[model samples]
Target: MSFLTVIASASLLAATGSDSIPRPAPSGPLVAPVALAVPFRAPVDTTKRARKAVTYSDGYYKRVAIHQALSWAMLPLFATSYVSGDQLLDKGDDAPDWAQTMHPIAATGSAVLFGANAVTGTWNLWEGRKDPNGRKRRLLHSALFIAASGGFAYAGSIADQAEENGAIRERHRNVAIASMSASTASWLIMLIGN
Candidate 1:
């Protein structure tokens, strides 16, 4: 009946539909319908999309754990080798029986450990080459370890000459120590970083 009521009813009917319009009561005043406020939503896209898959092998984590264990194991081996080697260097062929026996054994143990680590580490490195995370650190670790491996190999090659020559023994000792230090640094970088 009123101008505002008519306008409100017209707007409400237009917003909804004719069936949604409120009916007037016989005895009471006519009430206009209240239009519900609906929040706006963008249309959803339903097309399927592909996600990138991880490239590493199933044994990746296992190798990582093994590599870490081997790295820790290397510390004691290094200490044993260093102590026994220092004794041999100081006393030459007259070194104590334990030092004479332990030095080569420890060195051999270290070599075996390094060889195993080299295989696992290099394989893992190749597998993870595409991964962007910590790539630089991994690369540096590999480089240092490789250099240490070369140093160890050189030291091993001179072992026979080292027995007869004091100078050669000292050089061997120095090379082995430097190699151990490099490997230790490489181990520390990964341990501390992760």
Candidate 2:
């Protein structure tokens, strides 16, 4: 008798045979069709995959911290050595007592600092030789520092000669300055890199 009832009757008649009778409609509201709904799925497991492990030696971080601190300490020592050495060169025996005393003291301090750094750095470098990260930078820094060390050693060997000969004194000063410059450059590379 109504529009929905007629439509329901037509659907029921179509589903059944021509001779079959139509069923009565329910008294509730109409429900929407669910034919287009997607089926449910479980998440895939990722924990079973294989992976490579990378590790560092014991005390690696501690050694790195100490190396960095010693590097920072080198700045003041370098400045003191340079100033005192310059005064000693310009004034010869007339140089101030403090300058004369501070020169060797600062030089010794720098040498000790470099020695400690070299040991720690070389050890760490060898330990991490397999690591691919920053390999080039580390190698360059080590090379520069090694060259500086040799320059400092040569200058020290000529110290006695430098005291007696003006020419040797100038060469000693030049070598020391060059070594200091190389060390400074190496220090800067690490500082900027990190």
What is the per-residue lDDT of model 2 for residues 1-194, given as tens digits with 9 covering 90 to 100? 45567577778788875746745656666565448768765456745444435599668888999999999999999899999999999999999999999999998898899999999999899887887777789999999999999998898899889888999999999999999999999999999998
Q: Name model 2 segments beyond 4 Å from true.
A: 1-53
What's the distance in Å from true for residue 29, model 2? 37
Q: lDDT score of model 1?
A: 0.89
For 1-194, candidate 1 gives per-residue lDDT tens digits of: 66576777678888887766675533556676679889976566754444445677779888998899999999999999999989888888788999999889989998999999998998899888877777889999999999999999999999999999989999999999999999999999999889
TM-score of 2: 0.72
- State residue 165's C-alpha deviation in candidate 2, in Å: 1.1
Candidate lDDT scores, in order, read: 0.89, 0.88
Q: Considering only N, C-alpha and C atoms within 3 Å, which residue pairs clash in candidate 2?
A: none
Mark the regions of model 1 whose C-alpha exceeds 4 Å error after superposition. 1-55
